[model samples]
Target: MDSMQNAPSTEDTQRTSQPAPVLALLPETGVSYIRHAWQDMLSGMKLARLGATLGWLDIKLRYRGSILGPFWLTASTAVMVAAMGVLYAYLMNMDVHKYLPFLTFSLVLWGFASGTLQDGCTTFTSASGLIHSARMPYSLHVLRATVRNLLTVAHNIPVVVVVFLWFAVVPAWSWTMPAACALWVFDSFMATFLLGILGTRFRDVPPIVASTLQILFFVTPILWAPELMKTGQDWLLLDPFFPLMEILRTPFTGDIVNAAIWPAALGWSAVLTVVTFALFARMRARLAYWV
Candidate 1:
């Protein structure tokens, strides 16, 4: 009778049979996203050799069947600089020796800066075939675009050299020139990273980027000397591009760059880096789907 009483526990058996709750998986936090983004960039940088090779191939394919190949870039740039330099010097009543050197520096650097950003907008979109067909870090495409533009800039360097020699102008070559060049390269990567994501997601971005660059080219001191601006001269310091151009141009032209401009340029670079990195982190995961 005691054994039968102990076995009469259906309620206890039913309670024990119930399943325990499963813990829900947590969503990814911002820190994790940033970490992953950093990994992606590092992985891409590790593939720099591949990126550079592909970039070189791009140059070759672009000018295939041409006699001068990449040297065509140097020749065309020289012709344009010569024509613009003569016309602008006469129009502005500035000495050709001084004006031509300044113009050469301005145009070459501006071409690099503008080309980087403009190409940045097509970084991922142009590589859609590779992205879909292969498994690689999205940043590799960004590096590829940056490398291509850098190669283009290298081809244009001869133009700068010829202009300098023609005018008998010796470069002041400062430590800051290397620093500025490094900054330009770093900024190019950041820009390509940010714009690549946006460009992949939005089809209209490239046109808008191109149009904006065109407008900036006119307002920037590429065609005219900053010293000519008597009014709102202080506002030129506020122009983000002016400081960048000044820091780079001054070292080559032997002109004095205001000490204040260095801080401004660094500040702008920091702002661009931080903002682009954050966006890249947030968008990194979505890139594959978007592309």
Candidate 2:
């Protein structure tokens, strides 16, 4: 009995010798996780050259051995623009000279913004192998995706230029245009990280994103003018895409955007940036498993 008492109890030995159970494969706290996310994002930015090179390679591979290469996108866009412009102009009773250029510019910008968001939903999943094997920043995938789409937009812009000249539509450089472009880039970047992270976790996200974009196309004034909107229907201006599209299109078309566009655009940029960063930070550690 004395020997038994002198010896440590099983519970006492466990408490004394066993270390605290550590939660592995997880971040300690949301703040710490978010901090890590920022580090990766910043690191990705520093490696922009790699991301851009990967983006270019993606395009090259996509159109390999084709003489037209990315110009295929240009040709297709031109055909659609010409066909739609003629039919829509006739239906709306708008002058072909004016309507075609407006339509071209609007479609070009819309394609860039929408494509970025849609591709974002697959950013992580598409690079699953890379994510699993590579030690690079996760945001690099997002940047690469954005860069690829931007290159597509670049190819399509010449068509816009041709249409503008054909219709005698002169787009003067406006300070607002640059501002709008900056905002567009920021939105695209944030959306990629936000949607990409979510997309990896939820297999259903990509299709849902695609469907939502399709519905948004009809709601957005790509084929119609917002000025022609009825009075009580002014609520259409509050669409998240409306201000962003208007900010770019209005200035490019040599028209001034309403004052409200500034506030709306800025508000969205701020909110999306914050929310995206927080979410990405909280979930990035789990991304490896999800993919």
Candidate 3:
């Protein structure tokens, strides 16, 4: 009777045997998201060699059976440049010798910029199979798309060189040229990352981007000279593509780049990079799910 009285009650034993409460699943904070994004970007960059190889293979497979391979793009661009250069020069009443070089530089650079963005839309979606099958940094796919477009730009260099020789236009090399090119490259990566995320989330994004690019091409000073805009010459500064193209084209055409262009280019690049990184940080965790 004494032992039974001293023994613990059933309620007390149950209370003591129960497990401790677990903490709830908390959401990631802004700081943690940014940290993860930074880590992902760094990891992706380290795998650039794999990205480059895949990009090269993409080109090879695209022209597998063709004898001319990627040079077909070069030939077509050369032919288009020849035909359009002569026709537009006459139509605009501009001197062909002066106009062709500008047109060549503009078209080649525009192609690189536009192609990279367009391909950026498919950066993640196109690799959905690989993305699901293997775990890798999303930025690697971004680099792959950028590198592919870059290779196309490389193939088109011969066309630019031939035009330069035929017209005897001497490029005025400057420190600004390399600086502008580097900025352009950096901007491409930022744009690609942003576009890749949006594209993976929305299927309509690719068509929308393509359509917008088509409209921008005509409005941009690609086929005509900026000097043709008599009244709104200053408003050209409002055009996003203008500063980017001018900083690059000016150095190649032996023309003086406006002092204001560098600031504008840098400004645009900074804004793009910041916005892209922020959005990327916010969405990085959801990318695999979206893809």
Candidate 4:
């Protein structure tokens, strides 16, 4: 009886020790999201794991068959390169030798950029069944989308490798293709993280993004080297994705890291990460309803 009585007093003491009630945060604009976005992402970590697991399971189930189940990733890309090589080269009036590397690397990066954006749009809606049934936190769905894109990228990696091998475009010992790939991965996931939120609410976003990327492909200098033109018009490489192409194309050119690009490339990734997290935070509250 005495202990029970003391427990109530202790609870009261603890309650009184707590801080006073706080004001609700006014969810502001672009910057507001960044402030809370990291917190939300950290909070959603456990849920994200659940989503990633589900995505992995989905991949396994979908690809269950035959000897080299996922190795077909490489084979399929090789076939595309061969088919498109002759076709695109002739159409673009590009030298097949020079244009092949551009086509190959651009396609690989496109797969990363395009895949992340598209997958992010449907990240929440597609998992409606899981979201409803499991009563899981929503961020998990975002993670699952990112994870699935990763798996798709992994499967598609064989394509990049086979293309490089077929063309004998191996990196020199000093060059860091792996580092470039890691940079691209960081950019790709960040792309998904920001767009994933907007995509959930706006149904038209995915198709719009698709058309944009298609247009971007032609405009981004994938089929022809900007430097190869008769005149010095290399300024056209200013497209945002121009860096993506540069990062992907450098290794094949057997060039050392461009001293000028080092700061620019890293700067872009840092800016993207910061801004994207801000957007994610801004949109988090509306995410569940949007989905």
Which candidate gets the maximum TM-score versus the true structure? 3
Q: By the lDDT metric, which is better: model 1 or model 4?
A: 1
lDDT of 4 by residue, 1-291 (tens): 888866767778899999999999774676665656666666668566676788798778768986777567667767887789889889878777667766777676677677787787777778767756765655566667677778876876666666667667756544467777788767776777767666777788889989998998778766666665677444543566776657656765554545555556777788888887766666676766666
Model 1 lDDT per residue over 7-29, tens place: 94888898889898899988779
| Residue 68 lDDT, candidate 2, scale 0-100 | 94
Best-to-worst order by TM-score is 3, 1, 2, 4
Name the regions of candidate 1 deviating beyond 4 angstroms.
1-26
Which of the numbered candidates is closest to the native, going by highest lDDT? Answer: 3
Question: What lDDT score belongs to each candidate, Candidate 1 first?
Answer: 0.87, 0.86, 0.89, 0.70
Descending-lDDT candidate ranking: 3, 1, 2, 4
Show pairs that collide, candidate 1. none
Error of 4 at 180 (Å): 2.3
Across residues 1-291, which tens digit of lDDT does each residue of candidate 3 receive? 999999999999999999999999989998899999999999999999999999999999989999999998899889989999999999999999999989988899888889888889888888989989998988898888888888889999999999999989888897887888888888888899889988988989999999999998998899998889888776777777889999989889889888888788888888888999999999988888887
Q: Give me the runs in candidate 2 sitting further than 4 Å from their true place.
A: 1-27
Models 1 onward score TM values of 0.89, 0.88, 0.90, 0.74
> Cα deviation of 192 in candidate 3 (Å)?
1.1
Model 3 CA deviation exceeding 4 Å by range: 1-25
lDDT of 2 by residue, 55-128 (tens): 99999999999999988879989999989999999999898887888899988888887889888988988898
